[model samples]
Target: VPRDIASRQAKNMCDEGRGVGPAIKERDPNGNERMMRRGVYLDFSEAIGRLGRDAVSARYGNLFEMYQRITGDDPYEVPMRIYPAVHYTMGGLWVDYDLESNVPGLYIAGEANFSDHGANRLGASALMQGLADGYFVLPDTMNDYLADMLRLGKVDPNAPEIAEAKRSVEERVARLMALRGSRSVDDFHMALGRIMWEYCGMERRDAGLRDAIKQIRALKEEFWRDARITGQADELNQALEKAGRLLDFFELAELMCIDALHRRESCGGHFRAESQTPEGEALRHDDEFLYVAAWEWGGENRPPILHKEDLVYKDIELKQRSYK
Candidate 1:
C-alpha cells in the first residue's frame, strides 16, 4: 500500500479514537517522533503462533527484537502497536533534469533535490535515485559545470557578493544572539513543530491550514522577538546551529502551509482534507490545480510569490492515481 493512503487511514483512525493507544506517549531519537507506545495494535500473534516464533523471526527478526525491546512484549502473544511517522522528506530543493538548481554553480542531488519522487516516495526508489545521482548523473553533470568555472580562477573571498552574503549571515546571527529573551531555542522549536504537525501534517483541512498559516506567521514574528540563542556565532555551538536551522524551518513551514491551503485537491503527500472522495480516496483536479508551484520567498515579512509551471503531458495519459 502507498504510505500516503496508509498514513491518512492511521491518522483518521486515531482522530476517531479507534486508534489502539493514547497519543504520543513517547518519542524517538529525532525528538519529533511521536509514539503511542501502544499505537494501532496489530493482532499478529496468530501469525506468530501459526508460523512459529523461529519462522517469524527468520523474516522479521530485527523488527521483532526491536518491538520486544521497545514495549517489553513478546510478538508471539501480544498485538504489535504501530504508528505512522515521517520517514522521508519526499520533496527537497527544486532541481532541473541535470540535478542543478536555478542558481549557477549550485547543484542538488539524492533526497536533497525534489526529483524522482514528487511528493510521496516509495521503498528503495530513494536509495536507487541517490546512488544514480552519486555514481552516474551528478558526477558527469557537475564536472561539466566545474570545467567552465575552472577559468574564474579562485575568486576573492572579499568580493562584494561574498562580503554581502557573509554580512547578511553575521547580521542575522548577531540579531539572534542579542535577542536573549525569556524562552529557550527548544521552546520555540517545539511550539513550531507542534503547530506544523497538528495542522500541516499528513492530512490537512482548509480551516486547519488557514489557521496554521496564521499561527506560523505569528510564531515567526514572536520567534524574532522572544527567541533566546545562547553563546557566540564564531564558536561551534550546537544550540546556535539548532536555533538557526529552526529559524529557517519557521519560514519553510509557513510556505508549506500556504501551499497546502491553496491546493484544493489531495495528491500524494499533500492531502487536503477538503478535497477527497466519499470513500476517503484522494481527489485530483487536473484542470485547475495540475501545475508545479515554484514559490519565491519575498523577503522576511512579505508574502511569497508563486510561479506555476503548467503541466502538459503529450504522450502520457493524465489520469488520477487509484490507491484503493
Candidate 2:
C-alpha cells in the first residue's frame, strides 16, 4: 500500500516537474537517473515539499535508481504509475462515538470501527487516532459501560441467545466443511480480487461498476457452491480461517464500490470518473456531500441503508487541493 501511494505521488510530482522545469530529474554517472516524485509521503505532502530542494533531489535520486534497477525504467523523467491496492478497511462495522456497535454487547475499535477519519484519511493521523482510542478513549468509555453493566448485575453467558449463536456458528462451520466442493478456497479468493481490482479499483464508471457488481454476485454464488475446504472443524484450519476472511472481504468489496459510486464527486481516495473540477482537482461538493456515509447490512445482493453524518468544517475551509 505504501509503495502504491508512493508511486502515485511520484507520478504527480513528475507532472509538477513538467510544469516547473527539468529540475525534477537528475542523473548519476552510471546512467542511473532519479527524479523527485510527488504525492503524499508519510501522509504529508507539504512537509515533503519543505524537505529542501537538494534533499528532495538526492532522496528521489536514490529511490529512482532503486526503482530503475527493479522496473528497468527511470521514474524521474516519467510518471511512476500507481493504482489502489487494498491497504486497510477504514469503513467497517458501524460504531458510536464511544466505539460501541449496534450490537449492545460488542465494542469495536482500531480499524474495525468506523469512528474517525471521515472520507479521506490523513497520514500519521491513523497512528494518533488508534493510540488515542486505545490508550485514552476506550479505557474511560469502557469503564462507564462496565459500571453500568455492574449496576444491572452480572449477565449469564449460558443464556438461550448465546447458546443459539454458538450452535449457529458451529453448524455453519460444519456445513462448510461438509460441502466437499471441487475448487479450492484460494481459487475463489483470487477470482474475487480480480473482479474487485478490475471494476472497483482506483477508477470507476457506472457501466463498469454495474458489470462488476453482477460479476461479484456471481462469484459469491460460486464461492458458496463450489469452494472446497480440506480440514476438520474441530482443529485449527488456516485454510478455513482464510476462506472466512476472504468471503468477508468479497462482501466488503461490493460495499466499497457501491459507496464509491454513490459518492459522485472525486474526493481523496474515493475518485469518480464523472466528477472533477476544471483544474483537475478533486471537486468536493461540501455544501451537499460533506457527510460521513455509514452503510447498514441489508442481506446478500441487496442495497444497504445509507446513513449520513454531517461534517462541519470550522478551521479548514473547503478548497480545491493543489500539490503545486
Candidate 3:
C-alpha cells in the first residue's frame, strides 16, 4: 500500500515537472533512470453499485422498489453510496515540517511523508498535498540536504552495509524464482487479498479479526510452500514483480489488523464493531484511546511494537462524529 502510494506520488511529481503535455517526461539530472507517470484510480464502490443496480433492474424489472427497500430512500431524489476506498495512504514515514524523514540523507515527500492529514484526509486534498510537497516542500528541503551532502562529499555506495543489503535482496529474489512448486504466485496473492478484504475490511470485530489472523498465517505458510514461478530472477518477470508486491501486502495486512485491533475505539476509517454508541454511530473513547498506533516491523508473523502518538485536538472540538 505504501509502495503503491509512493509510485503514484512519484508519477504525479514527474507529471507536474513536465508542463502540460499528453505524455509526461522526466529529465535525468544524474545517470539514474527517470520515472514516468502511470496508474489508474478507480472507485469500486460507485462502479460496483451502478453495475448492481443496473443488473438488478434488468433482471428483476423492479428497480424503484428494490432501491427503496435496500436504501430506504428514493433513488431519483437521493445520492448513492460513496464511501472512501482504500485509495491513498495518509500515514507513512514520520517527517518534519520540511518533508525530511527521520533519516538525514533520505528525504520523503508526497504521500510517503505523514504531515498534512491529521486523522482523516479531505477530498481533493491528495493532489494539492502531492503537488505542494513535490513542487514546493521537497525542492527546498532536498536542496538543503544536497548542499550538506556536497559539503560532506557523496557517501560511497560501495560501503559494506549497502553492498550487503543489495546482495541480500538479490539472493531473496533468486530464491523466489528458484522455487519449484505447484500454485501460481497470483493464486496466493488473490487468496491473500480475499482474506484481507473479508476480515480487515471496512467493518471489523475481535472474533472475526482473531479468526482472520489464524487464516492469514495458514495462507502465508501455504504461499511459502506451494507458490510457483516460471521465470528467471534476473529477467523482467511480471509474475516475480507481483510476487514481491504480494509479499509486502501479506506483511502489511497483518499490520493493518494489529493497528485495527489495538485501536478499540472507532475513529474515521478505523471502525470497531465492539465500539459503537447506542445510536449505532462510532463511539470514541477520547480519554483512554486518543492516540495513533504506529507499528514497527518485528518479523514474519510476529507482533510489532505499538508506539502511540498522542492526537491533540484544538481547532476541532472532541465531539461525536455522525452521518445520518
Among these predicted structures, which one has the highest TM-score? 1
Greater lDDT among 1 and 3 belongs to 1
Candidate 1 segments exceeding 4 Å error: 1-6, 12-38, 45-62, 314-319
Query: Evaluated with lDDT, which candidate comes out highest?
Result: 1
How does candidate 1 score on lDDT? 0.78
Task: Specify the poorest-scoring 10-residue window by lDDT in model 2.
Answer: 36-45
RMSD of each: 4.2, 9.4, 15.0
lDDT over C-alpha atoms for residue 61 of model 2: 67
Clashing pairs in 1: none
Q: Quote each prediction's TM-score.
A: 0.85, 0.74, 0.70
Clash count, predicted structure 1:
0
Pitting candidate 2 against candidate 3, the one with the higher lDDT is 2
lDDT of 3 by residue, 1-324 (tens): 333233334444434653222343433312134554433232234643677756645664475567568869655444433222354444666677887765677777666666676354555665677789888878887888777767777669999989999999998888788777899988777677656655676567897787777777777787778889887777789988988888887777777777777778877666677987765566888998887666677775567877777878889888786554
Better of 1 and 3 by TM-score: 1
Q: What tens digits encode model 1's per-residue C-alpha lDDT throughout 1-324?
A: 566676777767775657776555533212355544335766777877798878888998899889899889987677777777766645677788889998987988777776775454666777777888899898899989999989889999889999999999998788877877788889878788778777888888998888888887787788778878888778988878988898789888888988888788888777787788776677898888878887888886899888887777899997777656
lDDT by residue for model 2 over 122-144, one digit each (tens)?
A: 55666666777899888988888
Q: Please tell me which model should have the higher TM-score, number 1 or number 2.
A: 1
Instruction: Report every candidate's CA lDDT.
Output: 0.78, 0.68, 0.67
Candidate 2 TM-score over all chains jointly: 0.74
